[model samples]
Target: MGRSRVALKFNLGRGVLLAPLIFLTIFYFYPLVSILSVSLFPAGRIDLSGFSEIATSAYYHRIVWFTIRQAIISTVLTILLALPCAYLFARYRFPGRSILLALTTLPFVLPPVVVAIAFTSLIGRGGLLNRLLMSQLGLSSPPLQFEQTFAIIIIVHVFYNFSIALRMMTGFWMNQSRRIEEAARVMGAHGWRLWWTIYLPILRPVIAASGILVFIFTFTSFGVILILGGVRFATIEVEIYRQTTSIFNLPLAAALSLLQIAIMTAMMLAYTRLQRNLPLELQATRHTLQNLSTRRAYTLIILLVSFIAMMIFTPLLALVVRSFMSSTSGTFSLRFYKMLTVNTRSSILFVPPVDAIINSVKFAFITTLLASVLGMMAAYLLARRGVFFARWIDPLFMLPLATSAVTLGFGFIIALDEPPLNLRTSPMLIPIAHTLVALPFVVRSLLPALRRIPPNIPEAARMLGASPVSVWWLVELPLMLRSLVVGAVFAFTISMGEFGASLFIARPETPTLPVAIFRLFSRPGAESAGQALALSVILMGVSFVSFLVIERLRTPGTGEF
Candidate 1:
């Protein structure tokens, strides 16, 4: 009878795992299968025309080459630029370190569209600097001329991904035994010599993980390229968006998406494997941190910190400045912000701009709930021991992250039209779509926390007359609360700023903030641009609050993300 009961309990545990699996199957794989079906076998017949065109066309070859070339450049430059700064963060106990680190990370979470808006306010033809130059130098035309340039694209890409390199490397570096640096110095090794022999090998795994993750992010960049790079530059993601919307070529769009997925999947798989090898041991950062006593060290810290602030914060500052500047004059005004409440568009479907904020908040709450619940379940499943499918299952949760948001959005439109899942038109699909994108992040945030909980704690509770459910509720849940809140905050932030998928699926009347800002920018006028900037500022503020929460709660230098 005891054997039968154990067997029954085992079956029940296994049965519980099916919840997340079923959700994944229904939402993730099914949409992907729809894309695959449409791309390869459109109109109930096999179709290779799109693939053939891609292979034969020189234009596409340029697009493909440019995408690869730019992503490579961005990743290499981000690492080169961020590594030294990360060294400071890893080694120093400095003033405002927590706030500075939080701000540095703030960019990575800000929507790409917001980043683009911020840059436009800083350097675009009608930007603050241009206007200042025009007034001071008596110039009729903007002198910066930085618009749509290759250099600007690279600059923004580096800006967006710099935090990933900084945070990841700093976290890994903090845990390294300081004795290694000491021993290397004792051998008369200095600077590059020390790096080559000691630091390079020690930091290689983290560098690889950071580089590959940033590479994937840059490779699939859509919003920055679309807004700042303009029509001249197009990544695969941008091209996918173009093909689907402007060209109305579903097959071609699907083909580009497939090509993108193939590349991203290979990179994500490499990252996952690398992540598995990253040191999981948590060491207190205080042991490695030191006071900066040397004048030279202080000078370097000040210079680097200033540069980071200039790079990361200036654009956002300019965004705020631009949003307040009156459209008709250079004087400050709140008209643009007030314009959010006014419907300037001459259409029945257009709602007040403020509704977008309300919708975003509402959808974000739903997404936070759904994603947190599913992510916790998924994390638990992945954290389980002795499962044969563990290796494959971990990557499956991550595939959504690797997949293009454009493709995912398009897949939803086509795949969810039938009964029992005919949610293509429903507002609930917005949160559901958001849940898919946010799930990976939510899972990643929780997994580290979950794994850190010792098995004996729960076992001890059970041994002390606690039921299985009670053990989890009373003992395990409290330990996980911080991580769970972090994950939920991630979900809320990502959902609030989500642009790509929301662009494709968001209803005309119920646009999210990013979608609303994008729509506003599509029209040409000072009023439109000002309102867009204003909305972007609001969105950035939301991200800032979320960042503060993460900075407060996250285990310093030990975050899995």
Candidate 2:
């Protein structure tokens, strides 16, 4: 009886792994493998010709170089800008500090298409700054020409990723032992010497981790490069899209996808190794914000805060302003918003613009449900099990995160077109793709909460004659509710904003908000452009509300992406 009970428990534990494993295999790995096989076995025989073509081409070489170079520059700039903000957040507290921290994370969740539109309204040829300069200086043409330049790409990348560095570094800094700094001070180290010797060395691992994450994100950039860079610039992601959609060259697209996967895998491995080497530090006993005691400190704090507020809000503000202002009338009105509900006979979209919001909400709701369940299972398998397989399974869950969504979307187009697995035209594909992107976040959030539950508590419940399900319901569920809510919110917001994958799979009649916005922006008309901005604002509002609710419900000291 004892042996039978032990075997039953073991099987139950392993059973939780099955759902996520099967889901990833059929939806994620199968699609990727299909793409690779098509590239290598073009004529039903193995060939290296596709890769050879990419190797010998100078155009491809420049693209590869540009991708790395831009990512490096973006990473460096983001870190430099984020360090001061990280220091401020770690060492001081001010009024509305929590609110400010929450706001800083807004850009991170906004769709790339929304971000591109926001920046264009801020600095593009007909953008606010350019128009102001042209009118004020009496120039025939707009000045501050930043669009389609390397500078704009770097700027946008920094805007999107600055929060990652700030949050990670600040969280790490707050938990650090202050004893080392005090010891160094007593040994006569001060100012630059103290910082250079003490803080930099300690912060190295976290810095590397943050940099690697940012690099990986920027390396797979799609919407930002395509919309902002225009025809002149093409990252690996942009090229892949072009090869697949415009040029009808699936072999080349497949080759590029393989290369992208290889590079991302290498970076992820480095990140894992560095994470292992990160020094464990005790949580601070108490966290309190310091008041500014010196004039210089007060001045610096005010200036920095103001600048950060401007950087974060200006573009979004421009988007809102442009959405309301009529280009033809040169005045503010509710015309663009009203147009959303009015179906036009000549419009490219088959349905009214507001319908896209309905579609997006439906997709987000389904994705949240699916990701939460799968992620909870994965988290339980990792945190509750003592099995050796859990070690490898943890990283497998993160592989979808590292792979580019554009690449995954492309794979879906090719891989799911025929046979028993044909899901290319299915409405379910959009939610499935979004869930893959959101699963990592769900696992990350739930894993920490699960680990915090002491084993003895569950054992005590069992000793009291409670069944496994009863113990979970009576003891574990309430404790994990906050984390579950956070994960669900993240999944919902990510799905709502997801663009790259949705672009490929979303049917015109049932377009999600991002896809609708992209189509609107691509067309040549002032009304369509204004409608795009209005839709973007709505998308941003949805994400913001979700995040605020998550913030209120989150467990204190739980880290967020």
- Cα-based lDDT for every prediction: 0.86, 0.86
User: Tens digits of per-residue lDDT for model 2 on 1-561?
Assistant: 679769978787767879999999999999999889989987899988879989999999999999999999999999888877887877776766676777777788887889999999988888998989888899999878888888899999999999888877887777676788889999999989987999888788888988998999999999899988989899999999999999988888999999999999888778755643442442444355578888867886787679777888899889989998988876999888998976544756567789999999999999999999999999899786466777667778888878999999998998899998899889999999999999988987887688778899999998888888898899998889899999999999999999999998998789999998998888787888888999999998888788777767776445435
Candidate 2 wrongly placed segments (more than 4 Å) = 276-279, 282-286, 291-297, 344-349
Question: Could you tell me the TM-score of candidate 2?
Answer: 0.95
Clashing pairs in 2: none
Off by over 4 Å in 1: 1-5, 280-288
Candidate 1 global TM-score: 0.96
Q: Against the true structure, candidate 2 has what lDDT?
A: 0.86
Lowest-sum lDDT 10-residue window in model 2? 277-286
Native-to-model Cα distance after best TM-score fit, residue 363 in candidate 2, in Å: 0.4
